[model samples]
Target chain A: MTMLPPPTSKKLGLVIDLDICVGCHACAVACKEWNDGGQFGPLPDANPYGAEPLGVWFNRVHTYEIEPKEKGAPAMTVHFPRSCLHCETPDCVTVCPTGASYKRAEDGIVLVDEDKCIGCKLCSWACPYGAREYSEQRGTMQKCTLCVDRIYNESFEEIDRQPACVMACPTRARHFGDLGDADSAVSKLVAERGGYDLMPEMGYKPVNKYLPPRPRRDGCAAEPTPAQEEKVDFSTSPLLRWIDKVLSR
Target chain B: MRPAFSVIFFTVMSGCGYGLLFLFGLALAFNPAVSGRIEGLVQLGVGAIFVVAGLLASTLHLGQPQRAWRAFSQWRSSWLSREGVASVASFMPMVLIAGCLWRGADATTLRALGALLAAFAAITVICTAGIYTSLKAIPAWHNRFVLPGYLLMALLGGAAWSWLIGEWTGGARAQPALIVALAIASCVLKHFYWRHIDAATPASTIETATGLGRFGRVRSVEAPHTEENYLTHEMGFQLARKHGKRLRNIALLLLGPCTIVLALLAITFQAPLHWPAACCAFAAAILVTAGLFVERWLFFAQAKHVVMLYYGGARMHDA
Candidate 1:
């Protein structure tokens, strides 16, 4: 039962744009909030108010500073959101000793059947993305389900049925749809933005794609004027001069 | 990469057990009259105890210990599952061989059962090695050196155990020359393995992990969380170079020169039932086991998982 399912035509995944992300951590919080009480309820925190708190989370956001290639050019800060890629040939599924980890053929969604999991933690070791989270309290492995319960729920409106992370993005940096479909909006976005996979050499063939940050045009290479380089001068403004005199008196 | 005590104990103890089983079976097949019935039973009993204790220790590593039986169901794909199956299957032949020894069976019957037992034991050890080799996420484990390292170490430890048991039971003695040779081979293999990992360049880096290499030199400015999470807790263990080198020296000394010297001393005292020979062999066995424990700890502690790249690790090797 740990055997991977045949490749599916419907490779539903997410496409994130790095240019607009502000590192607000709203998406990660949304994912945790939705999953905590949803189908995968009670993402237990070991120490809520203690010095060291550990818990399971399906998504995380990391910030990286990219040094500019040209000297004197300002560096760029990119906020990267990390989560499960739902790979085509995931070793995490095949490495399971118990038939706990599996991928669905219908939509290419990888999931862990908690009931069958022995909590061996092999699947966690096999994952290069660090997506799988083990719950000590429940004695089971948990991972990003891509919001399986909400994605297909008929009761919710079509617009509200996407993943919680996508739904909560303030800047519309995240998009979700069937990546397998060439003409889909998400696929078009990927093609236009030149979206790329993380660690492609690993050969997992990750379904999720990330759009690179756009080039900056803030004239970072321009030289500063002599006046700009000088220390604080009240001579440029009368209000600042009056305030400085009053303070000195 | 946390080097859990339960896992280290399981691998080291079980590997020694399988090695002892293999040697015992080979002895039974080649010379059925190597020892009396009681002596044979005692040898088999010790091996069984080590194997059973190791298996029990492994269950402690699982969160759902009661559901450990479910692991045997996925042999079609998983090496861990295959290991479970092979280990359990090996007990069948072991029990049969034990029964044959107990009844004082004929040489022909004992030979066939002995061979079967040895084959099962060897297969189980191979399955154990396969578990680490199959993992691609940890480049340190996914290497050519790991497979042979596991095999040679198991045999070396087994040879040491055999020498001690032979002395204790006054049965067919495992050649001291053979133990010396195995110890040398294991030392050489470990040296190469360590050198290989040290010099090898990591396949993945933080730049590639974020797919932002085109921008410039990418470095993590902030982590996902301030405190240690599961990923950091499990994979963030960093063994300092100074400590690692010292431990490696200790392991090599105990496993190589010291063990070889003891084995040579045992060989020098050629007289049968000599107390000095027995003492030397016993010391060699203890040293080998202790040495392997340090080696196993290094194996887990030094492995850098690729996932660390996302959490500010510059490269896989650096992590």
Candidate 2:
């Protein structure tokens, strides 16, 4: 049975603007908030105050620093927020020992039905991205639902019916729309900005797009700029004075 | 993967079941037995229970259960296929040998047939292990240690199960010897396998796994997919090095020493204690078996498969 609309109905997905993302983690928190309170119910924490704190989370933002290839350039920090790509292939669904996990062929969104899950943890083993997390108490697999509840809810305006993470993005780094439709906003953004996916060769065919970090201007840190030089306190700064003395001596 | 009851039962039952009858066939060949004329028919009857039941349990793992029969056709290439065929074929001589033993006659031809059946049964156990050990794609399984280790596992499992049977049979003579050999063999192989894996380096590094040239620092930059891919699902396995190390130590401590103790007990004690000692031997076997399952899981998890190369993991050498 088709629980979701087909690929033609502007199959919406996440388009993350890696350049604009400030590593704020607002999207992740908002996801937890909406998903926790919404139709999926609580995402469940094993021990919120325990020694080994582990539970389910759909979105996790990782921070990484990229050093310039050329000498004398400052490193740039980039934030990567990961979630289910709702891949075209969706290996998690195909490999499920029980049919609890499946993909909506129409829009290419992967989901766990939760009813048939025997708490096998097999799906978690199959996921390379570590996307699927085991719910200890409930004995089921939990993952990014692509905010299924909000996207189709008619209670709100048409445009606002997007995922919580995209809606909550403070820097406007996150965009939600269909890539299956060529003219969709997400597709256009992807075309204009060259969005990439995580570990493409693994071939899950993730629908979520990650816009690569925009190249920063070179020589940002080499031979301090005149503005930086003027800002530097020459005489009173012990570090500078000591260096100068050492050179003179 | 959780250790399913069916598999645990099958591995233990089949291994020792085959081991016992195989030994019976061997003893018959060597003329080493002092008493109890080789009851080929009865041995065949008992062997059928182990072989059939174990095979049935193995089928429970298959998604398409009916296709299991088709597994036998691949004997030319697949070890799994070879295992199926070997297991099935071992039954033929077994039945023939049983017929001979039941005639209340000592036929020279029947002894040769019985030995062949026992030999096939033992080979089937090895082939069952070869199914896992042959997968070169999985570095943990691809290792040289896997072949011997799995054979040793089958032997140990067989010995333990046979001990239980021996205990039930009012303390049989050869059970102790079988237990000692299997225990020592299994424990030693496990320790060696653990040490080998522990000392090994990742076949490839994150940079090389991605096929990115050496020297340039490579980070995820951004992951290519969101939901789990097959490579990550299959190869991104992690035994969490520390936990793997800890479990390995536990296996060594429990299985190794207990194997020795059980052997000594079997040598020293004669009756009720022998039965309990057999039970204890199996208890150690159970622990080792469970540990091996964890070890197998870690084997897959920590393997960092060649496919994980694209996911920014390194490739490893077989050695």
lDDT top scorer: 1
Each model's lDDT comes to 0.88, 0.63
- Across residues A1-249, which tens digit of lDDT does each residue of candidate 2 receive? 212224334455888887888877889889888988888757877556666445567887755455457666566666767677777655455445445676776676778877665554545555655577667656667888888898889998998898999898999999988888889888998998877766565555667787777766666676766654335455988888889779769
Q: What lDDT score goes with residue A118 in model 1?
A: 91
Q: Could you list the iRMS of every candidate?
A: 0.9, 9.6
Model 1 gets an lDDT of 0.88
Q: Which one wins on TM-score?
A: 1
- Give candidate 2's whole-model lDDT: 0.63
- Which CAPRI category fits model 2? incorrect
